[model samples]
Target: MAPSIRLSPAARSLFDEPLAIAVQGLGPRQQVTLRTSLRDETGELFQASARYQAGDDGRLDLARCPALPGGSFSGLEPMGLLWALQPQKPFWRLVKRDVQSPFLLQLEVFEGHGERPGRLLAQAQHERAFLRDGVRRVPVREGRIRATLFLPPGEDTFPGIIDIHGFGGGLLEARASLLANHGFATLALAYYQFEDLPQKPKELHLEYFEEAVNYMLQHPQVKGPGVGLLGFSKGAEVSLAMAAFLKNIMAVASLNAPVAATCIPFSYKDKIIPAATSYEHKAKTTSSKFLDYSDVLDDPFQAPGNQSLIPLEKAEAQFLFIVGQDDHVVKSEYYATEVCKLMQAQGKGNFQILSYPGTGHCIDPPFFPLYPIGSHPVFHKRAVLGGELRAYSKAQVHAWSQVQAFFKKYL
Candidate 1:
């Protein structure tokens, strides 16, 4: 019989879940090349191939077989299939194409390469998840904070989260929706702008976010002694502050975020959290002639607001800070380090820090290519985001997994 390929989860696989691939019906000890490819929304094609030799039974099991030479990666990395792909443009670009859409991965095994190529050994296609099926997307509009809720499929309660976005306002549904697929009840909170909200970032009230926290705790789909906060950039600052100021926050995860409040003023019951000291320096312009703030970042200690850090000592929630050393928008590593130091100085032990080198400011979910340089979506200017593709990709994967594990353990 001809060789055939089979996938364990043959129908659909979650973005963060692994799939097992097995090849059977091959000649004893046959040699073959397994090729994987996918196309992005922009019609860019990415492909990767690794040579392999089947066992005496004419079967190749990805779980046990080590890939031979002639591919982007040399050995077995758990998620090698993702990073191993040769990009026509960049991995980040491919991920950006349509994060909300499913990705179809085409796989084929060929007997050989070049002109002496043998017959096709096996071939298969599988739908990989960015947003998995069975997830319930609910609109949140009951309180002061307007947000969207994502509940994992089924009636089982899950650890809850209040997700916050950065300077570019508007509820970023991608991250929360993706996390929900991984078994969390997530609320993507919109602070300013978007859907009958404030037109711009200004006079922000922390009460709105507090209301979001209350909403998450009260959600039937949410399992909570306390919920968690997942935030990026300015949202990260809010996460830190919320864990310190609010009640019932079991944990906080800040991604490439800031130490001080940013852009707009944050107030809760007449208490104000001042914005960071920001400096605007021109780097370059995008094709649309927008100025890029590649070289400029908030200058810590340059303003009185920087002195008013979130009281880490008061925060009872566990903390995880994911920092990119090469982040161009903020000194993420420095801020994360200082936060750790302050926490330690205050005898707080509930914090973990992971800093990745060669990574940039806007670190998204896993497998997304390194957008080392790009035009800011809101600022509308091109600038260096800072990250090498390989390191950034690896960081994204590790950070994403770590976050899920963290929530499972603490929330």
Candidate 2:
């Protein structure tokens, strides 16, 4: 038989899983160049290639063979091509898409690693599924909340969720879009920095969120006497407050969120929750580009006019707090601990926390690189967001499943 390429599961896979590659019908020790390419959100193609030699049996299986030199990755790691692929520049990263779309991994084989005249050997492609098929996204412009609703395909009512983003300040559709693919009707809602919303985090009102809840509840495809809330960072606090003060919020999943109201003052009809006061630690930044926030994490209750603690005693929603122990952004693990203590003291039994020791602040969907530090998008200051690569990746998969199961039971 002529040389050909084959995939273990055959041309389809989940984004979280790996695909096995094999080349067959080559002469023993013959050099073969393997290449793969995937496009990003902006339509830029990110490519990676490697050279390998067929074994004594006239075949090379990625499962049994190692990557050889002369391509993008010069290491001996198996599956190195999947993670080590680079953009045109060293500083640029592979693009990650959060929309409901399948990423195509186009693969090709060449006789050798030739710059211009390499003879083609074999070709194949695999479809990696992330978002589920038939998921529909509708732009939300109703009321004060500017958002987008991702409704899974089908006429049957699905559990509804309102997804809120952090201090970065725009309507992020990724998380909500992915959730919709997992069988939930999700709304990625924005409080600021897009369209007519607030330019910054100021004068936040719970009523705007209430309007969002109403919108989700009124959707014909949403089955809800109540809905779920999913939020990150600053948005996590909003989710907490909504679950505490608003009616019909049955569940909430908060990722790297603070137990105390922090960053911005939160106001309801006649009351205001003071934000926790923060101060930068100048001494810790001498060795690294990211500033350490260890000093500002001092007990918020000790701060003057500190009224940021949400009234958890009033919340009826079931809660799942996902925190990273090494998160340097807002001391998520510490805040999660404090919140758990408060809930225990108040005799609340519907709350639980899943803390990953080595993860970071941005526990996004799986397969994204571990961003150790970056300039805060809104604040424009370099700061640490801690995580070891493998640990953070594991946290993402676990948390994604946990969110679905939690909402399935409570929403």
Candidate 3:
């Protein structure tokens, strides 16, 4: 009998790997009957399997084995039995498979984990929308890109919003979805996934975003010749950059996004720009990645001084900066102060900033619980784990209402 098999570290990292039972010390033409049983974390027997034959190589193929509940058996590569299990949820066990054998074989167990954080973060980045309502997709640039057209229920063309998503996250979020439901033509633009990934941050491409804005303005559903730009996190930074460089943009709203220029390597019209702007301590949690710009005004790689990239002073459109005071991911205070200063310097009056106290990053709309508060990587800078589940405050609601009013008048 072969020793019990276990998962290797590399295999474990892949998110999905099967559990197996190996049989050895057999001769050709020797038939070996095995009996197996599988159980979940509750210690209940979920599966019972019976037989297998020894191959010419003195190895038994147990591929096609019965799967326990919530588990699937496969004969695919890494040729072994597989069980689908969730660790955060429960545990499962596989029992003996050999018959007429005195030895009791115990298959090692593995659990299924919940969705990846990166995936969840991406999903949370976009608001959900119904197919029959609000917005529709139109092909652009030979279908290389798509233009989303948001239309109000009434025949009247409403103001348009060009939505941009954060870094490493794609379109399809609650922000745009809800905005479209509320009568705004929201175009969630995909600058990266619509085409190839850019080579670096300085080299990052904005041509697609620019085209998307043009497309929105030309759409019949749009009420005006231009549209507003609403961005979150990296998207917010992009919004700022676009407003700085693009003349057609009419308004901008930056939500809980970093004010610093990004550091992804990309080519901007054949120029090689280093990716050194966005920095995060991988060893730390999201809240622990809190950024402060007070010290780096002179550093080009830091915030504050990067203002040349964003003409906050020359912005012609109305601007709203929405941030959470307790947000650790991006220093809301730093961005608020810097943007206010820029607006003041430029004599720009059509701008406002609102901050929600006791709120963390990624403030959901009062449905979900407030997370990462007092944990290891707290953004609030306090050790208050599980601080209350304050998803949205009255102040946030008022601020949102104000946003709608502002856009209604400006967009």
Candidate 4:
């Protein structure tokens, strides 16, 4: 019989769930290469492979067998094929533009561990989904707000939350869709770079975001006297500002964001917060040829730059700051530490910081590939997004839960 790959429980599962992989009908003690590949909406291919040996019983269980050295990874990571995937195109990130469709994952078994696979022995495919059955994808276009609202399968109104993606924004619904499946009414809000929105706005206005917040509070399906805010990078910075200046923000989960306004100024009625820092001068070229943006922003605690700091002390909401210690895109640990210090000094302990060592920027859901490096989507320049593969993957998983729990508690 030909060696066959078996994916247990279900071939179709949510992206966050784990699966068991095993090979049957292989020769005893046979060496093989296991490879996995998938393409994104833009046709960018991401792939991963590992060397392995079959057991004496003519079978190989990924959970039991350790992957050999000199492949994408080495060790007994059953989900490594999914987590260790790297893009063939340099600096391209894997983001699901359409949550309605799953990423079709192709898996193959090769006869030997050569630089190139000796021969394809077996193959299989799996579907990694973002949205669960019964989840509703609702497009929201109410009064100057462009967004997508995700509703879990039920007639009940749930705790409401807003999800914001970072710079180079279009409407991103993947994270919001997945969060709704877990029982929250999640809204993926777009600030710019979409239908009718400006390509480059000189300043981002908080009044615009406040419109989104008010929409969530007024949503019939969104149970709220207040709503929760979840954001990453520039999005997180915006979330921080909303929590500080806006009402009806019950909680905030910020991922690798700055405490000071960055790149662009922020304005509210009668007030304007000037830009704090930029990538100029500080965005240095690394030895590896990739740009390291870790020091691009000016010091937020010092003269002039300190003026741009978000007055987070004024926020009444509970806060969760998720910091990636090894992030090369920003000084996440430093920013988070200073925020905590400032909060404590103000006699406010409404915040908690979770620092993940060896984790980098671009933290997403579990089982997604390691985005240790990428170019700025807007800037279109190469960047060294620091993180160990295993550590980054683990941090993504843990931080996701922490965000959910924090929201569930306060919202």
Which model scores highest in TM-score? Answer: 4
Tens-digit lDDT string for candidate 4 (27-57): 9999999999999998999999999999998
The residue-by-residue lDDT of candidate 3 on 67-125, one tens digit each, is 22322322231322222211221222122221111111233322122221111100001
TM-score of each: 0.81, 0.83, 0.56, 0.96
Q: Which scores greater on lDDT, model 2 or model 3? A: 2
Q: Where does model 1 exceed 4 Å of error?
A: 25-33, 40-46, 51-58, 85-101, 114-121, 130-134, 153-157, 282-295, 301-308, 357-359, 377-379, 388-394
RMSD of each: 4.2, 4.0, 18.2, 1.6
| Of 3 and 4, the candidate ranking higher by TM-score | 4
Tens digits of per-residue lDDT for model 2, 1-411: 889998876967666556778999988888888888777676766677888888998898887787787776654545555654445433333434455566788888889767652788888888867556688879989868799899899899999999998886777777787788788999999888899888875768999999999999999999979999999888998999998888999999999887777778888899888776655543266275557664464476455545778877689999999999888777777777777787888888888999997887777766554566765533456766677755666677788888889999987
lDDT (0 to 1) per candidate: 0.77, 0.78, 0.49, 0.88
Give candidate 4's root-mean-square deviation (CA, Å): 1.6
- Report the Cα lDDT for residue 47, model 4: 94
Q: In candidate 4, what residue range of length 10 has the lowest lDDT sum?
A: 371-380
**Could you tell me which 10 consecutive residues in candidate 3 have the lowest summed lDDT?**
117-126
In angstroms, how far off is 274's CA in candidate 4? 1.2
